[model samples]
Target: MRRNHTRTPLIEAIERHRSIHPISFHVPGHKNGLLVGDHPFYQGDLTELSGLDDLHDSHEAIREAEKLLGDVYGSLESHFLVNGSTVGNIAAILASCETGNIVFVQRNCHKSVLNGIRLAKAVPVFIETEWDDAGTALGIRLDAVKEAMKAFPQVKACVLTYPTYYGYTYNLKEIIDECHKHEVICIIDEAHGAHFTLGSPFPESAMEYGADMVVHSAHKMLPAMTMGSYLHIGSKRVDAHKVKEYLTMLQSSSPSYPIMASLDYARSYVGTFIKEDLDQTLEGIRELINGIERIHPQLIVQQADDPLKLIMRLEGRTGYALQELLESVGVYPELADPNQVLLILPLVKKGLSFPYTEAIGRINKALENEPMVEVIPMEGISTSRRTTPFSTLALSLEEMDGKVEALISLDDAEGEVSAGMVTPYPPGIPLLVPGERITADVIRRLNEYIVNKANIQGHHRLADHCVYVYR
Candidate 1:
């Protein structure tokens, strides 16, 4: 028999408990919003108590909710992640790999994936990612993974990021099949692809391709609170017990009740989404896009494989300047990179309305009020840097374990091994990874980012033109 798609076990449990209006004495110390005062949602903020299942143990409502989640995603076992996809990525790596094990990683993966590799004490062999004309890094080609498997036949696991940050997807099924053929456990960080299960037009999810494990940030594409994510164990190859243990160790003991409830709600939201809902949402998007195009003939709006993401750019203006102009009119985009600004449209349903007309008017006003400044050409910055099909760290983890660090001029540090990660925000791909050798090309890219004033994340002294290196 088919399970009821409309039921939300965890959320229902929370509401049942909230209706009682029981007295406080709980750990939260908020006293049921008595102290917070005037915050509407604070009264629902709860913790582990009778009738409310513990996140780690999960015997009642949470367990039932997770079962519903598994039913929706076709996973053998599914779990709610309260610490965002970062914890899911780490737990997946820990469950699949042991210390000193060889793991395949996509070079353009998020920093959290790299941190997971570091924590697992696994050696990473990074497969190069292909880039588009707009300088956005895309998924690794199947041939590249095959070549890596041929070279590193003893690889224990492979972690990949499906649907690039810009929402581009490639042949993920073949890549997962190749990993399975080599007896490598496949773990996917599908942070931006939680809605792929909606089917049609949207690219297929990694889980559908039989990935051993897949992590999804429900908050990214679904109607969930921030930090609410899901981790699915799809195959028997991985140790489910180990995944649970790591999650128990990594996640906060007192998880937020609201976030978990939202996870349950998000799952039901997707499961119950109908064709009418999709049609309405797409129509709203179409109107928004058409109105924005009317603002200027030169404006470029590029749609990706994922219909929800929109990329806007204009000639002679940097994405940063466009982002600023949009913000001036109270319209902020998801993020802005050197090449373009990304917009994340809401996934609405029937009877719901988005203020598309108001947004278009604000966008037009922003453009008319602030004239765009021509961006200076970044000469000598090589957008297409040649990278090997597969490469390893310049310095072994053991070798860099206790190495002394020294601050040196970035221009003079080309040959030195980096002691930190230097990543550009928005996309969050690291230009330099810890234990990787700094090259002249890396320095040039860093300089380009510095000149463009893109937000740089992680450790670095780019303002002083210095970086930490293993001395």
Candidate 2:
């Protein structure tokens, strides 16, 4: 049975504390925004005071807030995450698996997953999820999980990113069921799927799929601020006590109270209005997209794309070119790379008018101004992605030593052990990760991104400096 979604203990606690208007000699030097002088934060800025409750301990308002969060997400327990889903991933992986256990991981997992594995000192058996087996699009097929499990029965746990950066999800309940059949713990990074539970029309949340544990970035799809994430435990098999301990270890000793309050308010707001608002909003966006398709036949909408995320494949231009054109026309996108542009939407599009008509008009105007440029998808690629056997750079606890060297150029990158991760910003998915031998195809992909001027972040400076290689 679903519990009450109305109570917002954390927000209420903050409001009460702020309402009392108590003078401060607390740890925060801001003194409830007084120091900042006229800044917006002064109202909600607070510390762990009487009735406010500590996040690490979570006895009063924090506990109650988590309960309300659990009720909204259908979790056995929920912990407010101030450190983003990164800490949630770290703590969840550490808490669930014993050190030295082999974990089945999705190859397309965010960099944080690798960090979690390293922190836990867990061995990884990477599961492949390439698009059309061409190594561009990424998602795990159900059969892939079955095959990996049949191959590695000794694997103690499995972690996957559901609703990937592009907002793609598989039949997750079936996957969880399969994980249970193998007695493997299942952890889901539902960081982008926070809005799934707002209504039935959206994809089913992992919480409902009975994943042993799942993490959500409330800020991603919901109205909460960035880093307002939550870690939810679903199955009784998980050691909640251990999960709590790891959370304390990984999360900050003093968390931002305002972020926690936003989480509380966002949950209450979503639980109350998301379903009805979303239903109407989706209808309007659908109508707008239909019109957009009719007008711009060259811009193809992805088949597996989310309603909130508009992933477009341009006919003549690469994703970078399309992004440039869109920006020229004032249609700001969330993220764009070589082949695609992802546009995240604000909710209630149909119910309330968002500038879709204006945005589309601008896109058409920009397309008219741009010179034609033909680009092939994955062009000039010479190699394919190697399935992880995760590199010693990742698996071993030893610091990067004499074995780690820098290659100043991409020409010599291939076949060298990668000592660093190269990830696209905004989405934070890795194009190159530690421990894998850099392949020719990866080199080509990196060049394409560089040519397109997309931002790639990692230890190696691909644009100018050396590629970190583990010998």
Candidate 3:
């Protein structure tokens, strides 16, 4: 049977609805941009009306769009996420686990996962992923998950980050099977792997591996607006209705029409042309960077890697220095660590807006005439407990009300309990979560990130080199 790859339900509905020219009275003060005249964004801006469907209700166009979206991901059901994958993670975790239940979570999980545990009033059992020598990335280990479940049979679920920020993944099928054997549902934070469904050369998506639930930041990898994401329930073990209810509670009551429509368009776009697009883009990238002297492209050779991510190091330039060089040539990279500058690509639409040939030239010119420097893995200080304090907790810290106490520095903060999450961005995993004990090692790591100018989020008084701790 031939599939209809050209359909973009929500997008077509918006276009159809806009052509009607109806009189309006709606929640959005813009009211289809009448109040904000001549603004280009107004053309696509819309709200729930007689013809347009509501996001939370989703009986009309939105429902059809979501079905098409789900079909692309091979999910049992898929829901649009206006609040990005953060809310999707929250809703999935909340629906999967019970209050006061124990869950096995990779310590490299996003900060939002900790918040979800708090909201669900569940206890977390941290499972640390082994890191490469430089500690640049954390990879999943099937044995680790098995060992964690073996140690704590009460763990209701296990959460993992597939295709990490640096674009590498594991045998999630094996791990997912291991979780199911112990009656634990596996939830994958597949935010960075949204494009995995594009197929051929891309890693298999977590949804395809029979994960109970998977959250994807569609905007991160697809052509959708930022904050747009998709939540998929891959198995009946996850209650689809409950997940929707939690999404309603967690996401915006007034979701953006442009974001939702763009999601549908992205689903249609990628589903139709990604295989061809990837071939051209990968070849173009190879031509751009493969043969440059004194420069090494840190290509992740793992089968589960996302080839779209281009990480490279110029011999004499630090990641920061290389990043500066790239930007000077009008090529901005995604993020940089001390060792390599990362470029997540196809920044512009093909045959539409990209200066592809010009970009290749710019990149080549930048690497030219640059004197080489020694290439060595720059060791970073990201110390924290291999396992979170929750692993040893006798009770759930959900009801633990902590009073904030300010400290001058973390030098003497050993044994102090954390009042909030303190994490470095790029990979926004928490270093210290609220209600966890702050060890000297964690404190030292925080100081290291601060001195290195890594963006530290959450907690107060960070600009002063001190933070408020909970007692």
Compare the candidates by lDDT and give the number of the best one: 1
Which tens-of-lDDT digit does each residue in 18-91 have in candidate 3?
78875567667777778889376876677887667999998998998898888888888999999999999999
- Candidates in order: C-alpha RMSD to true structure: 1.8, 2.9, 3.2
State the weakest 10-residue window (summed lDDT) of model 3. 295-304
True lDDT of residue 275, candidate 3: 50
Q: What is the TM-score of each candidate against the true structure?
A: 0.96, 0.91, 0.90
Report lDDT (CA) for all predictions. 0.88, 0.78, 0.76
For candidate 2, the per-residue lDDT at 13 reads 83
Each model's backbone clash number: 0, 3, 0
lDDT of 2 by residue, 1-471 (tens): 765677788888888877887888986888877888848866687888899999988789988888888888888899999989998988999988877788888877888998898778787777876564223355676887887776777888889998887777777889789999888899999998888886556678888888999999888887788899999999887999999999898788888888898999878867766456776777767766775675555677753445677777677777777788788868888888777788787675234667767877777787664454564555412135455433223425443444656665778887777878888785687767777767787787778777877788887877674687776
**Shift of residue 171 alpha carbon in model 2, Å:** 2.7
- TM-score-wise, the better of 1 and 2 is 1
Residue 382 of model 2: what lDDT?
A: 18
- Model 3, residue 117: distance off in Å is 1.0
